[model samples]
Target: MDRDKEYRDACNQWLADCMLIYHNQVEKIRKKRLAAATEALTLCIKKQKKCVNETIKETIDFDTSYANKPSSVQMNVPKKVLEDLSFHSYIRMSATQLENLVSLTGPEMQKNNCFKKSIGVAQGLLLTLKFLAAGDSIYTVSCQYSIDCETIENIISTACKAIWNQLVLNVMPSDLSKNRWLKMAQEFEEKWDFPHCIGAIDAVHIVMQPSSNESPSKQKSNERNSIVLLAICDANFIFTFVDMGTYGCNGEIFRASQIGCAFENNDMNLPKPSPLNENDTENFPYVLVGDEAFPLKTYLLRPYPQKDCIEVSRLNFNCRLIRAQKTIETCLGILSSRWQIFSKTINMDVDKTMKIVQACVCLHNWLRLSDLSGNSCVRYMTTELVDQKVGDVFVAGSCRKSSERSGAFKDISCVGSNVGSRKAIQIRDSYLHYFNSNETLTRG
Candidate 1:
């Protein structure tokens, strides 16, 4: 009788175990179904929202957001707000400077405007200045200026065009006379102690975000596209010449440029080679200092490679060239710091980007030249940018940090690796000898 009871108890326990396993399997299946349904519902809602957004975007045309004109934007900014330095100095312009910019660009913006309620001249200038001062999008700018994205676009285009047109001549003249070049050389001599150096040449890469239509490879964050800005700056940290809107290798772009051709052909009306001292017989060209990316030529001087700098003369020559080269980099640093647009990648098309860059360059030169007292530019150019003699060593300025934040002030990676001519080597040696022998030049 006891054995029979034990068998019954075992059967009952076995049946309970099977029932618990079945319940667990059913519960798992039910939970999975619920999760799948929730996922499907969320996807449907996302699709609906996407459809609605697309329809709304279709209703609103980007180019015709204002009135009827493609280039006219209705502005709501007050005149007082536009003129107030405290209000608008986010773009780094003084009140006097802002007024001057408005005056320079006002006429072009006011010409042939049929719209009764169009953007005012000061308003347009402020809007454009805001755009150039940072990497904000048109829509983002629209929110701040109380204007539509499309109208903001037109205002930026019109304002940039006017700025470049009005200030190009006074700031960066396309054609400089021989006397002007000589004056530049003299300034270089006095300030940099670099005799016969009229300007410093270098290329700064302007970072660009590739449009969706461009190759997918370029759209990656790591593989960004860039347009090269090849510039020559004088001793006063002003751009003497600017060639922008070029893509590809820096050396190739420079070689294909008009100024580059002038350098090669000796047709830029640059000062003729002359002896620096009365006793010195070797004539030295008024040259532009450049980095290793640029090829050494009679008209341009690049430093000797580090691998070949076994002699003290080569190192000394490199230091002088580097000292002069700081002019261009410092100019770029100030431009980027003030304009602020160069701190981030430009999202516009190449043509539009070119116009913006040109406009900024002109503005940079205008402010630099107008501040005759040098007080107005003091904040932008502190002692951090100037070279100093630290004991026996000649130390470079620590202002490279200022340029590190700029998108357009960084050096190009793709070098030309160009083999310079024999004449170029002889000229470099001559300059090296001249610097090493002169006690005045050698003492830090």
Candidate 2:
């Protein structure tokens, strides 16, 4: 009996030992696997980093030989840039203008010491202007400017934010008093012959993604992820108001815009409805002119339908409406043609891209106010479109001839209905009658 009990205890001890050994072996295997997995993950991340920057490398060979070469920056770069007339093709601003911009934005652009020493205010501004004006790839700009890619991007973002903060109020003031609007209305009437017109409204599509971001199926199609720039321009081709960061047709985007929402709520601070002339019986409200894609409203006017143009009065109205709408088109052309950034697909993050856009908008207004076009300004302001004889005679403006914009946001045809309220139609008829009348005057 004693021997039998001892044998059972020995067997139990052996079983326990085996179980312990098994667990120990399992732990060793698991530790190896964990280390291997962590190493693999680290390698994967490194590979992704390289791939991300190299996706478009085949198209343009970047000289990363930058590190081995002498420093890519120079103190005289701004001066050289200003002296090179050809450089204007890359950055459209003049020396004095660029310097003035530096003065306004230099404080904001100032930076503290970091990974790489911060470039000077002027150099950083030059890099930003060149990148924005030409839409050069980040790597390309970095190599050309002798700056790091991340540094350049930060510089651009800072400069743009500075521009917006400094100039948005003075250039494109949203809270313009009634007096300012009256002045804008005066300019429209004198230039476009569309009395009581404050501005021309339109929407432009700016592609926010590169072709690589789209799936293969979508890449082949016309579809791309994009945002709309719903802009209103005065007779002087200055952006008075701009709302963006939406994706849709013009009508949908317009409905979602600030001006459109204000119009819907009847809360905008527009001039009250008044007679077209002292002798006129009906009172006409001040209005904005847009293409047929926009709904005709009491406060907004679009051209008559093609079928309705059978009558001479309707034809004349359409002609005049189209003539005023040219301001929107001209402004878009000038914006795109001069800046050149809107001409290409933007590959950056959406937030940064938006800041750049705001900066560009402010710059456009500044340039117009400063009269950067010099002698060309006189030619640009020359009378282009004339409908004194209606559709029977017309001439394209010098702006249209000079400003064949590259790849700026394009004007799109609206698929939705634009036929508006009875009151809106009545407003259109009143304008139509006023335009056809021989008594119509150019003075607002």
> Candidate 1: where are CA atoms >4 Å away?
1-88, 112-118, 218-224, 373-399, 405-410, 414-417, 438-444
Model 1 root-mean-square deviation: 19.1
- What is the C-alpha local distance difference test score of candidate 1? 0.73
For TM-score, the strongest prediction is: 1
53, model 2: CA deviation in Å? 41
RMSD in Å for all candidates:
19.1, 14.5
Report the CA-based lDDT of candidate 2 relative to the real structure.
Answer: 0.71
**Count of residue pairs whose backbone atoms collide, per candidate:** 0, 1
Estimate TM-scores for all models: 0.75, 0.73
**Model 1, 1-444: lDDT tens per residue?**
999999999999999999999999999999999999999977974453343432232221111223223334544442223234454346556655666666666667667252224566665677788778765778798798677676677778778888999999988988889999999998998888888998998787777768888777677643246667889999998999988766555557767766787778877888778997788898998888988888888778899989999998889889898988978887887777677677777777777778888998898887777655664532434465656788999876655555774464557754344678899888888888899986646554
How much does candidate 1 score in TM-score? 0.75
Residues 1-444, model 2: lDDT tens digits: 999999999999999999999999999999999999999977974453343433333221111222112233542242233344554555666555666777787666564231126566656677778877777888887787676788877878887888898899989987667788789888887887888898998876666654566577765533245566788999888899998786655557677777788877877678777776678877778899988888888888999889778998888888888888888888776666566677776766667788888988898788777764462222212234212344766555444532443354655576135879999899899898888887763431
